[model samples]
Target: MNAPTTPSTALDKHTGEPLRPTDGQLALAEAVRNGETRETHGTQTVPASRYTDPAHFEAEKRALFDRLPQVLCPSALLPEPGMAVPHDQTGRPLLITRDKQGEAHVFLNVCQHRGTRLVEGEDVQCSSKLVCPYHAWTYQLDGRLLALPRADTFPGLDKAQYGLKELPSCEAGGLIWFSPQADADFSLAETLGEDFSAFAMEQSFLFRRRTHTVKGNWKLIMDAFLESYHVLRLHANTIGPFFKDGITAGDTVGPHMRSAVGRLEEVEGVDFTDMAALRRVITFAYQLLPATVIVPSPDYVNVMVLMPQAHDLTLVEDFMLIPEAPATDKARDHWERSWALLDGGVFGSEDFRAAELGQQGLESGAVDHITLGTLEGGIKRFDETVQEYLRAVN
Candidate 1:
């Protein structure tokens, strides 16, 4: 990988640290100032078959999903050693654990003998070994086969050869990432880029997690988040009042995106004393390449992990991250209120409803393609990124 690039030249006065790219400094500044965003070189109409065909869906799993690196969760999920997390995804049963050394590891969640899932539930904390329930075969947090019941019964058995298969894993910017296959010198820093390291991803704790199964393609689920063109009509009763119509600006870091939108608070002229003041007024979203999205909100960042179940179904895990766990009942109440307002009102009612409806339309064979305007450039870039990856693979 090439050397990392320097972060933005703008520095915060208080910390002497580089400020995260703000709407004031990033690509959308001029357009955002004029209430416009960058347009594509030309309008592109993507075929509807890309969303409906089974062959194309399978190709995507192999070309995009299987080969690319994917996010597991935030590092805060495992604050201490011995913390274990089990995830049910598209392929093999997978589990994650922080070892005694405080290092995170990802592994196939199956036991070698009978292939029972090593961990039963969503998460756990074990100071010792992870024991398989099927045969009581035990393995260490770092993937070493420790012991099993009646070890003497096996002839020429090698514990070293039977250890759990570890997957490629890395942690950076307070988040964990993994790839289905391992690369000896895989660098998350290279894949994510230097700009990601610049942001202060504080010691945020997961507050409320809500998982939902949506009747829409995974890409369709993601596309809803990429464009703000329908905010006014779709989110009329919810967050639309807070944001201007189709007024968003963003730039891509490789396939990853960081977009900023003008909040109602920023509409009137305001001066900032520090970077902290600036962050309060604007909304920034980081659409991590392929499938994850992290939108840093006023109180918490909403982390959305989209897992494709089938061509027409998607499993989304939505996590709300706060700087610290709520210490008071009032604080918890405030979080609950905010979550209900955003997730229930905006996402559930506004964004997701649109996707399901769109899926019904596409599957009806009524439309051959979906049109993209210059305003929805972010959505175009996402499709282009997938095409680029698939082309190289093919």
Candidate 2:
């Protein structure tokens, strides 16, 4: 682990609050200290078809990913005005931009003139206006149609009606969320905003972001984060030694799951006010509903957005966020090393690899259902919540 960068008792530069644990988080620490963990009544099993069946995948798309609000990207991706990025992982062409007023907007990446894509690749662009390459149709960052090459030819063309088709979107807790539908219902997302804000995510800086294509179901990827049962085995060479076996406590905030992982060696007689000492003993993980995972490290955070494209294919946008941009070469090197270890080594090679392997095994029809033991009860709980949403739509 890298050395601590900030003093423990130092106030948070963003929230101006003590970096102490909350009452609920303290309860989790107490649970860890006392060796208390959550367990189900008995072994629970979810059918293998849940991860392999295409009909079920279609159902999930309609009931959950389609109807609900999902994370598009981090607001820091557009840290300043006149910044835009193209998002195509959701299987929809989307153009996310920050207007001159610094407000984030999500629009269909289609030009109103010829239905051609306004932006081609996934690169982030900085410009006051977006111009369609096919035709010289120009639009402002806010989706307003600014100019057209042959405006005189098309008599009485109302630019207002030809603006880009924008989806309902909002920025909260440092993330940008948008609904697949036209409605703007973000009640659940708003609730999660409070939880993420507690981590000071809104004030975090975007250090690095990468897109990963995982050969597994989106839920399979999500199931990996819901429990630490495989950490000792799957991540043994990477980050396993840092956490104690079966020393995690989890609770659900509405549809989201929150977990506290106890370190291998418990700290004795440590001061609660020392954030560094506290973090050394406890690692927190959050599984935000359908497929966003937020894990806060000692000096940085990882936010992953999982988008399911097929029954066995998932596109993961992994974001590494730091407390602030590295100002010195030494600081930059530290952050870079940290990012390489966690994002590239731990998650990419270990956790995601396990998910893909599980998918292969399940595809062979070797197992009818995957069994979850007491230590993996969080997976059962998350699957049950998913079923409720599916049931509602059915």
Candidate 3:
């Protein structure tokens, strides 16, 4: 491994700390430069039914999505106190709110009074109280029932008991995570929180976010980020030239996975002390178990949270987080161009389009299984992790 020719005193623009590669990152850089990749001993295949079977999809919802903790949104979505948003992508209407204390909560969107949805739409609503559209029931941002019209009409009505039903939730690593199951455990987030915090996610700025209803199984969308095998072919015009073909390294964090790709033509001779030089040579992608993909670029990070709506449908919430909000016209233009290239061109046009096309082909009953090459081993590993979750419930 090439050592830093000179230790740099420059601080990281985002975190204000002297930037250097970790031991693990150094190892990955060496592997990429040596033309080495993490591969399975033999070719692997996943059943087409895994992507198209209705029964299997429902099982996944019941065993995994319902029970496991999910990333509701980035903390930047609710950047300020007294902010609330409606989220219905999990096949259940949910309300996410941040109280005056800046604490986050996830509650069932249903009104406690008459079971009517208390909130509607995806836009953020900044208010101290949430008023039910029907009957005028009002609740605090923390899910406490505050007031209701015509209170005298109801006998022995306890306002305390009528608070909105809340689920297990916490804000960590600049993201809001919640479980749909009332009794779900959140122990898994401890490690993942540390990993995300390492990237200074909590301090980042939310530049832009948009939701898409894509025609593909949620896993199909996730599969695109786990491998670099298709980068040169599928994204040849957009991002291919910026990355080395078939040169990648990865490791698993329990069910989660981390992958790294090198951008430089030769990483062996590059200086590691200079953060700028090191960043130009390597990029990291993190797969938060289930369906969240976090890819940090040189200047910004992209987070995609996938919600499985059905066997062939997925709700994708895409977020682009930057170091800070743009303050000048030049800075805004730079961030805008980066967003357009990545969010609009690379992911929307190339990666997601490929997933939709793959779904269409699989739907036609052409192949029993989708074969994976050595370079695409991350997909096979992901499938295995998912199967472990399904098996636990059975």
Candidate 4:
């Protein structure tokens, strides 16, 4: 903890309503008050094996990816009553369209007759019913079999039994989440708490998308975003000037966590009473458990999702969701230039480069453990939460 940067209050600006920071953020602020910012969680470390073990990775796939509820995409992707899109990670497809009463439903994209994919390609699709290209087996938006081609050829066939497999899904905080298994621990309101509304999730729409196929363990890539300690060094030429080094608050929400750090020059003195000033001084990151990270910025939200491919390989999709459309060509050009900085700078060359090298060292069996300082508490908490989840899974 460090000395108090500013006196604390819990009130919003306009409404004077209560404002709550995540547990992690509050701890960090309190730590700063007590003069423990740089050294609070110092001297903590985890076994290096956790990062390199193939068995552990396999367990993660089963315990976390297969069992828990993870984000499929933003709920805004399929807004219209007949919108459908393929699940990028699974390539198995997902059908999300509303019924007559305007209720959303999700179902498998496979035809029951011959396991043919119902929809193909990348782009939002629209149709009241999905018809398989292979056999013309059709299904309604609600996942009920509407018709099967050549019905008389197949006698004693039950349309109800062959309806597309309905996966248990949840939409809260404006995200579509589901699991491979029959059950999942899912509650959008609970997972994100009040921050769900704070994120303005309903108003957001996908603005940009890019994928990075990197050679590194997924956890290694995630650890890069867990703390602000490296911002001054790795991002020195880029975001380094924008953020304070080793000043952050981390809060754990169930199996997930949130971290917020002050802007570099603004940390020494802050005016918590001025909401605009307060916001200008800090940035927030929501680590959505296993595979997603959402960072809420002033203009847009940054979402990073990792699709694990192997023990030391992962596919990362970075999505930027903005609430408003660009009104003019200049606004559009501004975003284009900003994305160039982002895609090629922070997450691009610097972060992924580090991820690749980190895996090499961890896999070399050279270090027994990775030591973490008090300032690196975010990483410690994140690793612990992950291990906790893995241990509890059955």
* Reference-based TM-score of each model: 0.86, 0.93, 0.90, 0.84
Report the C-alpha lDDT of model 4 over 285-377, residue by residue, as the tens digit: 878778888776545567788888877998887877665567789767766666666666778899888999999998888899998876677
Error of 2 at 392 (Å): 1.1
Off by over 4 Å in 4: 1-39, 88-104, 188-193, 263-278
lDDT-sorted candidate list, best first: 2, 3, 1, 4
Q: Mind giving the per-residue lDDT tens digits that candidate 1 earns over 1-394?
A: 0111222243533476755643333444334545656567677788898889878888888886787787777777787888788887746688888998989999889999987778877755666688888888989899999998898999789999999988987877667778876663346434453333334443567787777778988888788778777777787777776775435777776577777777533644533323344345556677776688887664466778888888888887887776577889987777887788777777776677777888899999998999988767778788888888888888
Off by over 4 Å in 3: 1-36, 263-278
TM-score of 2: 0.93
Please, what are the lDDT tens digits per residue for candidate 3 over residues 1-394?
1121222343544667865555655666677777677877878899999999999999998888888888888898988999999998888899999999999999999998779999999899989999999888999998999999888999899999999999999788788999877786666665666656655577778999988778999889999998888888898898887774546888776677888788436576887655546655678898887889988776577889998888999988889997778889977787788888877888888888888999999999999999999878999989998898999998
Please give the ranking of all candidate structures by TM-score, highest first, separated by commas.
2, 3, 1, 4
- Best by TM-score, which number? 2
For each of the candidates, give the backbone clash count. 0, 0, 0, 19
lDDT of 2 by residue, 359-392 (tens): 9999999999999987788888888988999999
Predicted model with the maximum lDDT = 2
Steric clash count of candidate 3: 0
> Comparing candidate 1 with candidate 2, which one achieves the higher TM-score?
2
